[model samples]
Target: MIEKHTSNNGLRIVLENIPAVRSVTIGIWILTGSRNETNLNNGISHFLEHMFFKGTNTRSPQDIAEEFDSIGGQVNAFTSKEYTCLFAKVLDTHKEYALEILADMFFHSSFDELEMEREKKVIYEEIKMYEDTPDDIVHDLLAQASYGGHPLGYPILGTEEHLKGFNADTLRNYMKEQYIPENVVISVAGNTDDSFIGKIENYFGSYNAEYKPSNIVRPTFLANTIERNKDTEQAHLCLGYDGLPVGHENTYSLIIMNNVLGGSMSSRLFQEVREKQGLAYSVFSYHSSFLDNGLLTIYAGTGKDQLPLLRDTIDKTVETLIKSGLTDKELTNSKEQLKGNLMLSLESTNSRMSRNGRNEMLLNRHRTLDEMISEIDAVSHDSIQKVIEKLFNQSSSTALIAPDTSG
Candidate 1:
């Protein structure tokens, strides 16, 4: 069973003690990400994420890295569309040390002006790197089109101009306002006990102020023209449509549709595009949803010569599925594959730690493994068809990336 507690200051902690597990996994999840930024503030969340490691009041930057390296422990962090997370996995004996280090990184980081200036150059290079890669750029173009003018449509990495303008005072203000306990949660798994819970309270329980999340109004969906023209050899293609958010009843069914559409090698897109026609090297579909909005995108990379035929093939696949629907065998197989993947993830203490945190922050409840397996098992072909029709209708947005190979 997973234990949950909330401090008077609104700091929520979830503990799942796995006795036989040899290490402890500790994580801190902050609710701010790209979706929460303003135009001037875009990418600041990601930039701030990087700055957290520079140092803290009690730990120098090198001290932070070496503390765990000396323990044969693993430490890392990432920023995504919805949240930022920092985690560490170390021997059970070092549980308190891990928590203390994590807290210092989160609450007391010194965002030096000198360091921020240097990192600005690094982030600008990162922007150029994304532009140089067709695969990365296509996804960026897709999001830009999917959400249109919404902040959610903007790239997670703020533009080069914005990064140049960021400074320490600005970053410190952003952190003070955006990274707060009212919008944060911590998840831990392995070698946990009441003492572990007590230590968490001692370290983090004091930050429990009633901080309100910033208010930003986003549109329900976007229906506008989106096209990107780049000088590349192959035309990148993407189409966006509506999807259900993560906790919806039909979310699992949409996951199945995505699986069959492009998720696995045995999927329809792979078999049709790669095996039968050999028209493209890669093609797949994915379902993405925010707290209230969602997007289902299909991406393909092919030459200008194959553009017409590629579109036709993709359209044909969607039309066929909407009409003929999925077979019981396909549905059953996809579910099993998904279930197996889910179960496989539980084997790692790090994966479990991150899952336990993100799930609660997103769902407000922890679902048992059996409950998830049963949900996957219950999806039927008829329901799958209904979801496809709803998601792939004509009212979707399309964006593409291509090279000027003719030039």
Candidate 2:
């Protein structure tokens, strides 16, 4: 079970105690990411995440590293389109120590000028590395095709020009604007009791930032096509369709439908595009849900010369699924697989912390295990058909990266 508390300043804390495990995982979830940025500050959220580890007021980067290593704990952070998380997993005996170091990194990072410049050079190479991976970058291109000039279309890694402009002031100002109490959640899981919530509050509570009304604009779905001819040996293609937002009524149905389409090894896309025709080595699909919107993405890579055949096969597979709908076997198997995945994830404290943190951050509510299992089991063919129709009813945005053989 999970216990919830709200700080006086509106920061929320969620704790789950699993007495059987001697490990604990703590996560600090911030509801600000690339979608919260502007064109000029496209990747500041991700950059700021990197900066938190560079140094704090009292701990050098090396000191922070050695502290975790000394205690056999792990710490990491990630930036996404809509949120950022800095998390640590440590033995139960070291939870309080881990929390102190994390709080230090969060509140007192110096953002030194030298450290910022060094990280900028590292990010420059990171950008170049991303550019060189055609298959990886094809998805970013799909975002550009789908949302055009919206912040949602911007890459999480801002351009070098923008990176060069970031300084201590730039980061501090952005944090002041977006990292308000109402936009943060502290989640902890495993072997910890309710008393830990008070400990969390001591470190995170009472801090105040000027509340600003949200000016987030809901983005429109566009079906633009983007093609970048590169020097890669294989062609990478992605197709995007309009999807339901987080917590939409038909989300479970959509999940089952997507699993049947391209989400797994036995999925139609995998069977038709790869197993039967030997078209590509990797082909899959997934759904990404945002605050007010969602996107379903299908991706595949094939030999440059077989691009036409690969695309045709993928199109035919999708067409067949939409027209005929899912089989009884597909529906039953997908539901069971999803239920198993959900249950298995609870075996680890890290997964529990992440699940609770994300649910609290996005939904502002939590459902019991039985309730979730019942919902998954309740998925029906008719419901899945509705989601299929809703997802594929519109034209799809497309992106492609292939060799520039035409020249």
Candidate 3:
């Protein structure tokens, strides 16, 4: 059973207790990211994530990393367009220490100017790294193509122009606007105590400051193609279409639909395009959904010569899905695979903690494994067809990054 509680300050807490687990994983989820940012303050969420690890008021940077390591705990954090999370996995005996470090980092961050300036350079290097990599560049292009100029579609890593001007004030003020009690969820899984939750509540209860504003202008469906010429061995391609939001009931149907399309090694896209035709090497499909919008994307990498054949194969597969749809057996098997993956991953405390926190942040509620199993099992072919029709039955925006044409 998954237990849930709403604190007086409007913080949501979800707990999952499983016996036979020797470790505990906990996460602090702040429900703000690039999607909530404007052109002026974009990437500040990701920036702040880096700064928190630089040092906190109570701990040095090395202290933070070493303390966790000394206790054999795993700690890390990441930011996305919709959320930022800090997670830790530690032996059950060290649960309180992990929670203490997490609370300290959350509320007492110094955001020191020296560290701030250094981390900016680090992030700048990271930006360079991503820009130099063709595969990374392609996904960003796909987002821009699918959502146009909306904040939802903007690159999570703010542009070079935006990052250059981003300073400590830019980050602190953005944090002030976005990191509020009303927009936070904390989760812990494994052998943990109810009283430990109270300690968390006590620490976070005093955080009364109203956080950053969220004037998100949702992205609209855009139809366009963007091609970036690059010098690379393999051409990277990404095509995206409109999809359903996370909270929609059709979400499960779309999950099933995506799986039947290109989700597995045995998937039609893989079998026909890679195994039989001997195309380049990689092919996959995925769905990215938010509270108000979604995107369905298919990605492939092949030589420029194989582009036409690859495109035709993808188009034919989609057209076939639209016509005949998926079978009962395929749908059943896909759901079982998905369910199995979820269950299998739960064997790790870190996975459970991250999964619980993210789901609560996304859905604003706690759901048992049984609830998810039922939801996936209840998905039907007709329902999936309707979802597919709504999501991918039209023209989509494409982003292609291919090698220099002279080759």
Candidate 4:
């Protein structure tokens, strides 16, 4: 069972106890990310996440690292399009210690001038590394093609120019605007009990910030095609189709549908693109659901000479799926696979904490295992057909990174 509580100041806490495990994972989730940023601060949310570990008012960066190492705990943080999470996993005996350090990082980060300059150089290298990976950066190009000039199209790692301008004031001001109590959730999973809630509340609760009503503008999906010429051996292609938002009633249907399309080795994209045609080594599709909209992305990488065949094959596959829909066998297998994946994920404390944290942060609700399985089983052919039609009714946005034609 997942226990939930709302603190007096609106910080939400979710705890799931797994008596079989000897460890606990705690995550601090904030409902702010690149989507909430402007062009000027396109990467501040991610930059701020990096700064949290530089040092806290009470602990040096090395001290923090050594403390966690001494306890054999793992700590990390990441920034995504719609949210940021700072999380830790440690033995149950060290749960309180982990929480305290996380809280200190949250509330007392020094954002030292020297550290800021040093981290800026680190992020500059990080940006360069991302630029060097064509296959990886192609997805960011897809976002640009799909959302056009919207903030949703912005990359999580802001530009080097933008990163240079971020100082202590910039971080604090951004936090004041985006990191309010109502937008925060503290998630815990493993051998801990509800008593741990009080300790979390003691640290995170009672903090007050000016609560400004949310003014997030929903992004409009565009079917624009964006192509980049790079000196590369393979052409990277991505297709983005408009899909449903988070917690839509047909979410299970879409998941099963995607699984049949390209989510697994037995999937059509994998079977047809790689096994039979030998067009590419990597081919897959995934769905990303945001607060108000979603995107279903299909990706394939192939030698420059085979790019045309790869595109034609993908188009034919999508067309066939649209015309004939899913086979009953495919539907049944996908549903079972989804359920199995869910069950296997519950075996890990980190997965449980992440699931609970995201559920509470985005949906503000949790469902039982039975309820989830029931929903997955309830996905029917008609429902999946509806989702398929809904997702592919319009032309898709396209992004491609191919060898330079100038040569």
- The candidate that achieves the highest lDDT relative to the unseen native structure: 4
Query: Model 3, range 1-407, lDDT digits (tens) per residue?
Result: 67787888778888888778889888999999888887687888888888878888879999999999999999999998899998899998998898999888887788888887788788888989998988778999998888777887777778667877877677777767778887999998999767777878887765766644566666778978999888888889898989988779888888888888988887888888899898858898888889788888889999988888999999998989888899878888999998999799978887888888888888876677888899988898889989978977689999999977765
| Residue range 167-276, candidate 4, lDDT tens digits | 99999999999899999999999999999999998999999898888888999999999999988899999999999999999999999999999999999999999999
Q: Mind giving the per-residue lDDT tens digits that candidate 1 earns over 82-121?
A: 8888888999998888888888888788887777887788
Cα lDDT, all candidates: 0.84, 0.94, 0.85, 0.95
* Model 4 spans > 4 angstroms off: none
Q: Candidate 1 or 4, higher TM-score? A: 4
User: Candidate 1 — which pairs collide?
Assistant: 9-208, 232-403, 232-404, 235-402, 236-401
User: What's the distance in Å from true for residue 282, model 1?
Assistant: 1.5
Error of 2 at 90 (Å): 0.3
Estimate TM-scores for all models.
0.96, 0.99, 0.96, 0.99
Which whole-number lDDT from 0 to 100 does residue 38 have in model 2?
A: 95
Write down the worst ten-residue block by lDDT for model 3. Answer: 205-214
Residues 280-338, candidate 2: write the lDDT tens digits.
Answer: 99999999999899999999999988989998888888888889999999999999999
- Model 1: how far residue 362 lies from native, Å: 1.3
For every model shown, the clashing-pair count is 5, 0, 4, 0
Q: State the TM-score for model 2.
A: 0.99
What lDDT does candidate 4 reach at residue 169?
Answer: 99
